[model samples]
Target: MHRLFKNALGLRKCRAFAHDESGALIIFTLYILMAMIMIGGLAVDIMMAEERRARIQFTIDGATLSAADLQQTLEACDIMEGQFRSAGFANVHVNHTRNGAQYESCGVAEPDADIAVDVASVEGIGYRRVEAEASIRVPTLFMHWVGIDYMDLPVSGAAEERITDIEISLVVDVSGSMGNPSTSGETKIFELRKAAKEFFTAVVKNDPDDDSAITSVSIVPYYHTVHVGEDLLDQLNANGGTVSVQNPITNPPGLTSVQSEQQFSSCIEFTPNDFKSTAITPSQKLTRKAHFAYGSSSTRFPNYLQFECQEDRFDTRYAANSRPHIMVHRTEKSQLDAHIDTLTASGNTAIDVGMKWGVALLDPAIQPAVKTLADDTTIPVPSRVNDRPANYWVPSVSANPQDETLKVIVLMTDGVNTTQYGQTTENQYPYINFKNSPAPVWRFKNWSTHEGKRHDRWSVNRNMEWYDQYLIYVPGNSWSNRWYRPGDPNTSWDDQWYSTSEIPWDGIAQMDWVDLLDDFHVDYMAEFFWDEAERYYHSYYGWSTREDPMEDKLKASMITQTNWWQANTNLSEICAAARAKGILIYAIGFEVNTGEGPMRDCATEGDAYYFDVSGREISTAFAAIANHINQLRLVQ
Candidate 1:
């Protein structure tokens, strides 16, 4: 009975203890402690992994950029490996889409795998794209506790950029004013030479083996005229057309007349409005003949001359293979540099014509003509983009953002607008063009004494003999007696110096003169009658402005001022159009008296595209342009 009672008591005590829950807190605390330790360990591992991934990403990013150079070779891979090793990474897998070793430069030839350079030609421009990928297996420390012995840290990077391949037309003003000395004691032309050479070096580096690199340039040096070498005109299909200038058959207005076909200054006359854009259609080619003025204006209508142009020298130059050949484009940088050596400063400024020609070469509508020329000649025209029309240009802006190509023009000038000259058949009487010695074309010195009075007696020489003698003196002895008639065809070569009765102009005379009265090629010549009336008015009256020249003789479209402001404004519009077409226009107004005008407006304002420089500043201007263009090119 006692044992049974004790057992029942023990059971009751056990039940009480179970119901009490006294040790429950301590047991739960111990279990919680164990759980906390496991959670803490996982958190520590995650933190360590994150920090390691961050470090790997930084290393990979640096590696990618370093290895992305198109100029680098396959040895860049070894460099990358070294970098990885230095960064505490081993057995790193470095891979690329092209091999830099095969091509000294990305475009030295075509690209190969193991190289990072490859940017598809956007529109017609070449670009460089690089992609670098790197991966490393990192041995895990803390995470390995969870059955994870290793971790993959992969990082990749890429760079895309627009790089080089430019077709530039450097339209420089080889105008007479460029020969003037600057404050720095250097001639504008001399400064330009130094600047231009540096500019060439800056923009087009020494990359001889890059066949795929299509960077090219056209040196369009202009004065009162741009001799569109017949090769160029013919190639560009600017030939085969006829311009009817004043008939050379007669000078001044003739009561009885004839209209004959004669080519004008290869500088076809285009209205100021014509230059609003670069889309010059086929119909707008050079087809008008340019006319020059007679010093004096008689109610009977003064005689005029055809502006001397390049048509006559076309056949000769093509055969001689001489330099300063009409270069509409040149593929190699060396070719451009060589051509630049042939520049000479002479004649008046013709920015309108120069800029127009520059724009024409970039026009897509003219591509067909260019292709025709290329096919016929040895020129390797840029025809990769458009095989038929030969599209090598890209629009400035379009619905498609990919349309991109660098078409540039660097136009430099040292003077403001001035009158252009032309020549006339004759005076019905002979007139002195100018002295053979170097002097202004508009040089019409009114000597104090015309009639010697045989001296003191102011008398006019009635002898028409001098006029007769002047007409007879041709440049070459071969063409001495054989003189060309103004409006008459080759059949009309006049050999009539013996008949001096027709000789007329009273009072003045010039000594060494090769009367280009009816000729176009100016290998040899005298002063011209261009802007004669304006100059006469200036000398007779006083210096004048474009606003209102004395009596409004109409030197150029009747708008006589120092500059052709209207034309210049038109040029501005053309520049804006070029810019809109994705063509970069850089302008240097070297020693411009007006301090502003067409050249200033031709380039973007305040963007280093327009430089109104002086003396040596020209070099800085050109270098800046080169650098700007270089920066604009495709690259990573």
Candidate 2:
């Protein structure tokens, strides 16, 4: 019985051990399942964080880019805020400061969630950067049974915007050719004017108000020369006038003899006292001839009559209007308008002169603005004589204090240099004369003293008949005279008497003279470009307000003017200088045939600033240039 009881106790202990082992196994299995759930939840949180990071990155990047293009700092901030919200980052908080670097953000989506982002170096870099962070509360799945409710998942990203500033210059052709009708039946000049005005308005409208903004524009108008009107005229007197008139044949008035008589009579009635009673001679009679023979094809009688009348009336009218009457040419509004109206195309082109004058006006060395009292007081003045002991010099009243702005020149020409006139030379003449020597004669008297002894008498006489002899005389000749006469010592009738005479006459002939040719003075060329640049710059900045006698702030670039039409070999140097000085040089080749020598030398490289436009396309080319300049400005 004792042995059996011991065996039973052993069996019971074994069963109890087995039961404890099973319970331990169950506990192990539960732990393993809980661990698996936790692992899965962590994986999901990681994925969510990564996806959020990507979304935030995309949103920040887009917003930063948009902000970078903004003209104002406030606008940039607004853009960032709006963009983040739109991207579903409603919980994101943004802080902007002018401390010149980095956009900072910090926020949480829930009590258990942590979210943070850093957009570093927002100002130190050329681009603007935005840092973003997103966080969410991730509830545990099976792990919830272990008393852990949720975990915080955070994602972060950064975005940046790239920015660049550009400078541009526009050169336009305003030559007479631009007035030609376009395919649209409007003058190229008209189209160009419209387009240019639009472009100017648009660019000015969109330009950034920030002082450190990136873009600026300049307009240059050139024909055979450019006309910058009053500003340049006031600064350098560089504005040139161009006069164009329709061909007589094309603009003839349709008037018959009766109509012509009527018109003439009416004109006579309105004529001033000085012009009244001018003789109407038959010389003014109109002959009936084929219009074609006169270089015309119009068959209308009125047209023919008008054509004839125009030819007769043009001279008188032109003479009266073109008389050099004005003295100290003024450049006021009325004057400029009148000058423009008076511009008649009748003189040789002088592109160099025009360009020169234009550049002079914009030369900072010549015309700078005067400083105001405020600026003068704020900025320290440099000592003029440092060698001397320091003393109060009444602050040498601020010379021109205008800002040193960019310079530009636009050069254009219709034709190359031609012959110049108004010069003088010397004149000379030659002549000749001859003289004759006297002859002697003897006579005997036979009579009277026959009674006394042989009487003898002697008489002498001479004739001067060689004075009219012909002799060819050459003034500059050294060789010989065609008609040379040798004088004789012995001659008729003289009683041992020597006869001699002086010849005072000499042949005279005119000498040939040579006059030096006048050099092709292209004064208009330089003046045109300089004036255009100055005028445009001034217009862009508004005119100067000081009364200081400084150089014109709107002068053309002298360096550019001197080299504008130089050889191609020097083009790179010329363009380089212009670019360095922040000057945009625009060149137009009008009716050019010299392989673009001048145009290429004058224009910027890559054809970005040069145009070789035909006469009819000049306006179009100018419009295109203005449009390009407009594009450089910020767009709202």
Candidate 3:
């Protein structure tokens, strides 16, 4: 009975143990926890791998960009390695163009593809697609029991950059206003000088990497007029042959025009619709001639180029002074620096001429000085792979259509639009004192009116001293006034009998060229008729101001004011054209007391285009523009 009972108990116990729920739930829970731990470890590893990938990619991008810089003298490989190591990356194998054109690296990335956009260009301009692959083994904390010792993470990254070629035309205002004090208490011109020098230094960096491209700079200095070089002046039709400009008179055969027998310095003159355009498109639409009817730089100018009578100047000033012209065509670092120092301030502010020349210089159609210095090492142009305008600005990379060249014109001014002097006539001669109190005594208002008349018809109203006194041969009247000043308008002139004592009565008949030449009469005309009629004796000869009428003629008679306000249209059009053609225009206005409205309109689009005010800000503006331009010179 006891054996039977013990067997039943043990069978029941075995059945209970087989169906037990408590311990089974505990075992199942333990197994699930172990699996969850393994999965969590994998998730941690993946998260770490993703973080590593981002970090490594950032490092690679930095390395690639730095290595592609034109100013970067360090090797690309070394740069990449250094960057990766700094980013806490170990055992990284980097490779690509070394000691060569590109800044590419990576042991397993495509080496030849997108090596660099233009690494040899200034400041890493183009896209240098850099790729980097990282292999990292993460030690697992919980997966070791499953025979997996570590997690293999492969992190790869790639990146690209682009920089274009830059061409800059720096136009500054050398007008009188630039000499004024600025906000920083310095001369605006001086600030401009400092700014310009800084700009040159910042842009024209002699980088070995920028071998394929260059940053070209040209300067255009201006005042009331921008004087072009002789090359452009020689190209004019007036300079060619048989030059004739319209005159005021119609008599004396060919007396109705001024002829250019002598070459003169080129001046900004008429264009389409009697306005100056920045587009100096060397076409024959409008004649490109300088205002050379008057050549004397002094206040007195011979009103006519060559006519019946020309005045002899007394104490001229500009006989030896070279006609002023701009100093920059091609910009070398040293030469640019020198030019910045030599800029002086003295002249009316003519922004129109300045802007015209500034934009005109950049136009490929016209660049004589630039062409001359394109081959010089001091001022290099763009890339010279093709024969087009040798060493001129062009795209660094030919294959990439997106790669374009950049051209810039920095136009700066300190004053408002003042009137420009214009000479619309030729025979504006006033050989006799224009408005002297004794003028018009002879009644010869126009020289051409007496072209074919007789001497008796012309009359002199006075007589005077004989030493420095003037004598006139009125056609058949003869050189000696021995006919007696009969019926004089002022009776005192007739009573001046002592004046006849020194008169050359006998020498009059001996005069051979006495066909009554008006030219000879004008050269020795007795001016100041009122005063001379009262004078009797004076031993030493003296020059009377009335004898030379050149000063009066040039003062207001020859120089006429033009509506320079019309120049705004030309200025805006030029800026628009340049901007349309991918050219950048920066217009800076310093102490623009009149208004910066025109200057603001002249600048290109965006804040980068316009800078109004002076002092350190001028330099700041220049530096900003330069940085932008320099960036263009870089190939990524």
TM-score of structure candidate 2: 0.35
Worst 10 residues of 2 by lDDT: 512-521
How do all models score by TM-score?
0.54, 0.35, 0.57
The local lDDT score (0 to 100) that residue 496 gets in candidate 3 is: 27
lDDT of 1 by residue, 1-636 (tens): 999999999999999988897778999999898777767866776677677667665655555555444454444445555566687765354433343333233223323322222222111224444555544355665556668876666656554344545667788888777778886798777787777777777766535555444556667887765766555455432444332333232321111221222332344555566678686555444543332322322111112222334333344322221224346655655666667777766566778778877877776776656666556636544333222222444335344232434678888888776665443222221222221121111111244334233322212233221122223222222322222111111222321321222323243233222223233223112121222223322332233553553233322221122246655676777787777776778888887768465666678653457787787888888887877765533222
lDDT per residue (tens digit) for residues 469-544 in model 2: 2111212222322112212213322212111121112221111110000000112211222222222223223333
lDDT of each: 0.51, 0.34, 0.51
In candidate 3, what residue range of length 10 has the lowest lDDT sum? 510-519
Best by TM-score: 3
Off by over 4 Å in 1: 1-66, 75-127, 132-157, 160-165, 182-185, 201-211, 235-261, 282-285, 289-326, 377-405, 415-563, 591-601, 604-608, 612-617, 627-636
Over 4 Å off in model 3, which ranges?
Answer: 1-57, 91-166, 205-216, 235-240, 243-258, 261-264, 272-316, 319-324, 367-405, 425-564, 632-636
Ranked by lDDT, the better of candidates 2 and 3 is 3
Winner of 1 and 3 under TM-score: 3
For model 1 the local lDDT of residue 190 reads 78
By TM-score, is 1 or 2 better?
1
When summed lDDT is taken over every stretch of 10 residues in candidate 1, the lowest stretch is 435-444
lDDT of 3 by residue, 581-609 (tens): 55678888776766687788877774558
Scored by lDDT, model 3 comes in at 0.51
